[model samples]
Every structure is written in C-alpha cells, then in structure tokens.
Target: MRNLRYVLLAGLLGTALSAQADPVSYKLDPGHTMVLFSWSHFGFSHPVADIGITDGTLVFDEKNPSKASVEVTMPLSNLDTHVPALDKHLKEPDFFNADKYPTITFKSTGVKPLGGKKYKVMGDLTVHGVTKPVVLDATLNNVGPHPMTGQQAIGFNATGMIKRSDFGLGAYVPKVSDEIQINITTEGSVPKAGQQ
Candidate 1:
C-alpha cells in the first residue's frame, strides 16, 4: 500500500513538470517573413503582389499543438504589384481603400494538428473593414536555432484562399476572378530576455 502511494506521487510530480513546459512565444522577424498574394487578371494571366507584415506574435507548442496560436498584422499600404500605376489604383476607394482601412489582421481561432508538422489553422481575417473566417493549410518548415540571431526560431509556410467579393471588393468579380490566393512564409524567433 505504501509503495502504491509512492508511485502515484511520482507520477503526479512528472505530470506537473511536463505541464509547466508551456508553449514558447515568438516575436515575428518581419524582415524574414514575406506575404505574397495572387489574383487572376481578366483571365489573361495571374498577377502577384508582395505585402509587408508589420507585426505579429506566434505561440507554438510542438508537444501539444493545440496550444498553438498566431496573431499577424499586415500593412495594406505596403502592397506592391510591380506596376506603379496599378498599385496606386488598387489602394483607391474602389479597391482596398488603404486610407480608410490601413491594415489587415489575422488572429487564430483554433489549430488542429494533421500528422507530422502539418496543421489546419482556422482564424478570423479582417480586411477592408470586414471580418471573415479563414482557414490555412500550414506546414512547419523548421524549428531550431536561427543562424543570425541565434535565438530559438520557428518557420512556417501557409496557404489560404479568400474571395474579394466577400470583403466588398466586387468591382471586377468573375471577370477578374473573385478568388485570391494568399501565401505566407514566416520565421519567428524568441526575443532576448529584455527585448520583448
């Protein structure tokens, strides 16, 4: 009976220690993260643009992936479509209206692990003053020490689709393709003790 009590106590202690291993929080390294978007242009060809990430935080737990979460902010005014004229037009009231709504944001609602290093991330995406639920098929690229910063870092690539019309940008609609593809590649690192 005494031995059984000792075993139970040891098990409880181990469980407590493991639970204390919370997910590490990573501050986005914006310079290393890239946000790319592509859309059909009148069925002739797909035009792609690069957007800039302003800030974000990623909390990840490899052992208990359900605890993973992310919050990202992208500056709408930083869009680059290669063509200067078109880029300016895109920010007009008819399109993104960057002046009125300056930033796009995404906050994770849930994360479901799919096998090894793959996850289905569901989140709320706010763009152009509208909010909608979005899902991304995410893959964990790597998690280790970063060569430049030497901080523990994590890399991920995620892909998701959104409809322009859904967000009230229905000017071209089917003609220009209402659906847009978003690709995100990011590397986040644990900040230094006082840096955060």
Candidate 2:
C-alpha cells in the first residue's frame, strides 16, 4: 500500500511539473508596436490611416501557442488619416463618436498555429460599444534578447481586415472603402513592479 501511494504521488508531481514548464507571458512594448490601416478611395487615389498602441499585454506559451492571449487599447481621438476635414468627421457621432467611446479595445478569444512561425489569432474587438470578431494573420518574427535592456523578448506581425460598417463606423461608405486592412507589430517583456 505504501508503494502504491508513492506511485500516485509521483504521478501527481509529474503533472504539476509539466504544467509549470510552459512559458506563458508576452509583453507589448509600446515603443515598438504600431497599427496601420489602408484602403482604396473613389478610384482616384488611395487613402491611409494609422494609430499606435498606447497600452497592451500579449501572453503566449510558444511550445503551445494555441493558448496565447492578447489585449490592446488605442485612443480613437489620436487617429491620423492625413485629412483634417475627414478626421473631424471621423470623430463625430456618425463615425467613431469619440466623445462617447473615447477608446477602442481588443481581447483575444482563440489562437491557432498555422505552421512554422505562423498563426491565426482571433479576438473580440470593441469600438463604439460594438463587439466584433477580428482575425489577425500573425507571424512570429523572432525570439531573442532585446538589444537595449538585454531582456528576453519576442516579436510578431499581425495583419487582418474588417468591414467598417460592421463596427457602426459607416459614414462615407462606398466612397471610403468598407474594407479596412490592418497591420500590427509588437514586442513584449516581463513586468517589474513599483515602476510605471
């Protein structure tokens, strides 16, 4: 009976060790992260827009990247589309309604590894109180030590598209291209408390 008890204890310990072996954190270093969007215009010229991630957290266990998670928030009022009149329009109620929403957010639901260095990351994106599923085609750029701080870090590129109308962002419609393509690049590190 003692031998059987030992075996069971060993099995339980092994399970705990296996779970702890998984590395599961990615930090979004805002300095190196950016989000850009571009779309076609009224067949005359192409217009583009871009924003930066003010704050975010990216979590992952590279060995089992399918369990990864991500969260990001951006200031809608900081939108830069290269046109003042259009930017003003975007801030109004018909568009982002910046006065009410203020910020846009995203949180991951599922992560699927496609192959070596590639993945499909899906999440719920909330803008103007509307939550919609957004899929980002992700690529693991590299894993190494950050040159500046010599800290362990990883990089990734995520790109995807969503219809503007889906988020109640329909203002110009056919004239401004409902399809908005996005590209994101991010880097992260572990947190050190007592420091903001």
Candidate 3:
C-alpha cells in the first residue's frame, strides 16, 4: 500500500512540474469503463467475460506521453461469467482462488505513444497472487466535454493477450485456453470531491 501511494504521488508530481499551463487528469469512471476479456475454450471457442475496476486514475502527459500513467485495483472475488456454476468454479483455487487472493491489480510502469492516439502500455498485473509483466496496445478514442457537467472525458481501447499459466491461473489447461485476450474500454471522468 505504501508503494502504491508513492507511485501515485510521483506520477502527480511529474504531471504537476511538466505542465507549464495545466495538467490533465482522468478519473476512470466505473460506470462508463470496463475491462472485457475472453479466452479460447479447448483452442476452438472463446468464452467472454468482464471485470469492473473499483478505482483507477490516469494522467495524460502531452509532452511526455511516456510519462503518462494508469493504476487500477479490482476485487478478484467479483469476477463473473454470467453463469452461476461457472462463476463459482472461477473463484475457487483452481482459478482465481478468491479466498487466498482477494484482489487483482495493475500498476503501470511505462506508457509509450506509438503515434497519433495509439500507445503501448506496460505494467505489472497481479492475479491469483502471482505478478507478471503485461503489455497492451491502446488506442485513444476521443477526449471531449462530459454530457452532464461539461468536464472533459477521455476514452480509450486497450487489448492484451496473457497466458493463464504465467499468472498461476493454469488449473484447467486445455479445458481453458492458455491465452486470454483482455479488452479495455476505459473512459475517464473528472472525480467529484471526496470521491477518490
């Protein structure tokens, strides 16, 4: 937890010092953002699902987009596939082991702009108590006025593929596809006071 606080503070500081005019901050909106992902079944079919972020933040560094950062913490136990029995098994030790590891998280270490609105985000992802480096291809959708308050909102699409075994999520190997593709459609909204 101390490490998390430190990284966040550092990110804020970088954003604060670099912006001669103003810094842009984005608070990931749980209602408007989601991480939808899927994995193949027996190497033939794909089973899709999604996880909601309980909290997250992002800073867009126009000059040094490489300095841009994103952080997210999600409740592992909340994972679902819209199927009751399957959901139960997913939470067991063979899968998420929700009882042992209550949370899954990601802390970005680097963000490199590919060109225009495309970027490559690299971070450490923790799942089932194992941490691994993951890279995602991200596309900035748009930035514009918020319909409700006119505050600026930023949207994005990011995708990555992970091998379940790499993260110790290798319970049902061939039964569950080894490679899982994660899709992130993130929309960042200005945070309200007392909301962070």
Candidate 4:
C-alpha cells in the first residue's frame, strides 16, 4: 500500500511537469516581423504596403496548440507603400489618421489547430480606432535553435483579409478596393537571461 501511494505521487508530479513544459513564451524579433498588405487600385493595379512590428509576444504550445496565444502591435507610422505621396496620404485623417490612432493591434481570443502545422487564429484587430474580429490562417514554419542567435526560436506565416471600410478607413472604397489582403511573417525567440 505504501509503495502504491509513492508511485501515484510520482506519476502525478511527472504529469504536472509535462504539462508545464508544453508552453513557451517567445519575444518577437522586430527586425524580422512584418505585415504586408495589398489592395487593388481602381481595377488596374494592386499596391502593397509594409508595416513593421513595434513590439509583441507569443505564447505557444506545440503539444497542445489550442493553448497558444498571440498579441502584436504595429505602428501606422511604420507604414510604407514605396510611394512617398501615397504614404503621406495614407496617414492623413482621410485614411488611417495616424495622428490620432498611431498604432494597430491584434490580440488572439482563441487558437484552433488544424491537421499538420496549420491553425486558425481568431483575434480582435484594432485599426483606425475600430475593433473587429479577424481570423488568420497561420502555418508554423519552424521551431528550433536559431541559426543566428543559437537560441530557441519559432517562426510562422499567416494570411488574412480585412475590409478598410469596416475599420472606417474607407476614403475611396470601391475605387481603391475596400478589401485588403494581409500577409504576416514573424520570428520570435526565447529571451536570454538578463536580456531585455
């Protein structure tokens, strides 16, 4: 009876440790994290813009992927469309109104893992002061030791769509194509001890 009790306690402790090992917190590498968006322009061309991440964190669990979470922020000030005039126009009140809402953010409400390395990440996206639910089809690219930093690293590629009008940024609407396609590539790593 005494040996059976000892075995049970050990089993419980082992199970707890295993569960705790599933989740890992990763600090997003700003230099490598970016969001790219493209929209059709008057049925003639598709123009793309790039936005770099300011700061973000991701909590991921490979064993139990549904337990994963993500939070990210990108500054509108970082938006660039490769066209000086358009860049300036996009920040004006007629568009993003960067002076008022300087940033765009997303916080995941839930993560649903699909077969293999794909997932549907549902989150609330805030842009131009309006918040709307968005879903990103995300794929885990890799998770292992970083080649450059030698630290544990993870990377993912995700794509989603949003309507500019829904966020109140509908300056041109149908002419500029209200729907925007967004592509995201992010890389994160476990921070080193004593590192910021």
Flag regions of model 2 displaced more than 4 Å. Answer: 1-18, 193-196
Global lDDT of each model? Answer: 0.92, 0.85, 0.84, 0.94
Of candidate 1, the 10-residue stretch with the lowest lDDT total is: 17-26
lDDT of 4: 0.94
The 10 consecutive residues of candidate 3 with the worst lDDT sum are 16-25
> Which regions in candidate 1 have their CA more than 4 angstroms from the true location?
1-18
What lDDT tens digits, residue by residue, belong to model 3 across residues 1-196? 9999999999998987766544478899877777877987777768787777888998886667788899988886557688878888888887888899888899999998899999999999998889999999999898878887887788889999999899888877878778888998989876667766
- Which one is best on TM-score? 4
* Residue pairs with clashing backbones, model 2: 27-188
Query: Regarding TM-score, does 1 or 4 come out ahead?
Result: 4
lDDT of 1 by residue, 131-162 (tens): 99999999999998998878999999999999
lDDT of 4 by residue, 45-112 (tens): 99999997998999998889998999999999899999999999999999999999999999999999
**Clashes in predicted model 3:** 0
Clashes of each: 0, 1, 0, 0
Cα TM-score per model? 0.91, 0.86, 0.85, 0.94
**Angstrom error at residue 129, model 3:** 1.1
Considering lDDT, which of the candidate structures 1 and 3 is the better prediction for this target? 1
Per-residue lDDT of candidate 2, residues 23-65 (tens digit): 6566688788888888878767777777777888877787788
